[model samples]
Target: MRQRHKPWADEFLQENTHLIIPDPSNYKNKWHEVFENNNPIHVEIGTGKGQFIAGMAKQFPSINFIGIELAKSVIVSAAEKVQESEHANIRLINENAENLLDMFMTDEISTIYLNFSDPWPKNRHEKRRLTFHSFLKRYENVLKPDGELILKTDNRGLFEYSLVSFSNYGMTLQEVSLDLHALNDPENIMTEYEEKFSAKGQQIYRCKAVFPNQK
Candidate 1:
């Protein structure tokens, strides 16, 4: 089901424009300058409503976090969450994942997160999956040497597909878990969808992969 467009979406985004990098592409190779610090950067693509990234920013104050979402309507929810508190380490970007290369130079990012991304369940739509190798190539270009890509999803099929895709890309896989909540990682921070799905007894899948840039 598609989400209905909220009437206030545009207004909300405009009002909170300071929290977003209006010309992210211009900051290519200069992300740390934008944040005004040299802290390691962690990014979350499709950061719906921002809970996970916000929690992470609170948990790790020394790390800079960026949350990217394409839809103005969807991203407004995330902007609202940031506005509710003081989070200097976090910022939101309204942009598409496909255009990430335009906004970041090679080896600019330290970590990438793909949490409950759209499955795009049809075989013909495989390229649209965030875990697709094509997307992984983009991520690899932005990630610093040995940078990590962490993923969490409730869709078993997507999880399975991502596992094979990451393997085929020759990434070193680690921390693979078919049931994330069961692992009981004390540091685990739940995303909005994760909380709802877990309440319904759904098993969440998660994994970490490192891009071996030299190998």
Candidate 2:
């Protein structure tokens, strides 16, 4: 049920071939080397289509962005965005969220973006959700001390579950907003998912949680 077009889709895919890392194991810890000056890496999970990550790469010139998506079709589309931009700071990987920890080394990641992630609604399937405690633990491994996880979702159930999951993991959570649009913060860039949810009048929840620094 996800829309495939982003207006500039075809142009973006032409030059982004290099951004797609084929062998995650080879450069597990050196992801920053792909960019100039080893810039800090920021990852966007579930990068549907590509507009969100593409627009972000254009906006945040300082940080290197990588969009990880499981769907080959969408990842190809996402890859095209980085390719079209021809920006060295952005990349795309076609991988599931569960494989995140296995692909990246500890303290190698700087920030994570979970934009409108799949909110597996069934109670029993909650563990499969990205914000589950186990997933947070994996995220903590890859994240740098003081690394931040930013999550956005229109599903109230998932948002509430995320809050509890984050808190139980000892992460310091802040900037909690049930209605993201009211804040009007520049950091809160609109993704394809955000735009759709907002149009539907669903309350988009957002939060930033940080990992503890290494002693």
Candidate 3:
């Protein structure tokens, strides 16, 4: 079973002001209304500290962004920053990624970001990893047919495991890069975790898994 977050997790959930939930039970629709007249709706799981989500929202004013995290304390800081930044195209929510099916409708999400998700490295704990096959099934339910799941991590083993899992799921991998920081391309935006891990000389693995037929 998934252990609950520390106490007072609900307190910060209450403080998340910018979170736009038309209906928590139907999280898939209307999220794209905030931008582009109709921009793509992207979501980030485990948006810890909110740096990545906040920065991306600013960088891509055209795309709608959602930062979904379970921990309230960690999310409160991000919520406060969104308030201070006056970002209208982004939102932060306190919720587990596992219940995504209950939260979103089919074909709702355009992209998913899984940056530095828990590795769950032990053998018995492997099923808990965000990239596990079971989690991928949940993701497929909410993501659109052409939606892509972007994952970034510094754990070598977990990255390799994810690649195999995606292959097994018949998802196509594109723009797969082993080290994002080394790429001098402007297309690469440095997430907060990516910067910190790179500073410590750790390699980052990134991949985009696309679901062609599944919604």
- Best by the TM-score measure: 1
Model 3 segments more than 4 A misplaced: 1-12, 20-23, 26-37
Indicate whether candidate 1 or candidate 3 has the larger TM-score: 1
TM-score for each model: 0.96, 0.89, 0.87
Clash pairs detected, candidate 1: none
Question: Mind giving the per-residue lDDT tens digits that candidate 3 earns over 35-57?
Answer: 43577788899888778887788
Candidate 1 Cα errors over 4 Å, as ranges: none
- Cα deviation of 32 in candidate 2 (Å)? 2.3
Rank ordering of all candidates by lDDT, starting from the highest: 1, 2, 3
For residues 1-215, write the lDDT of model 2, one tens digit per residue.
Answer: 66464555334444444776766667788776666467788888888878878888888888888888876667776675667887667778777889887788998888999998888999999888999988888889989997899999998988998998888888888679989898888866788878987998888889999966652
lDDT of 1 by residue, 168-209 (tens): 999999889989988889889999999999999999999999
CA shift of 89, model 3, Å: 0.6
The residue pairs found clashing in candidate 2 are 12-80, 12-84, 13-80, 15-83, 16-83
Error of 3 at 130 (Å): 0.4
**Alpha carbon deviation, residue 117, candidate 2 (Å):** 0.7
Ordering by TM-score: 1, 2, 3
Off by over 4 Å in 2: 2-17
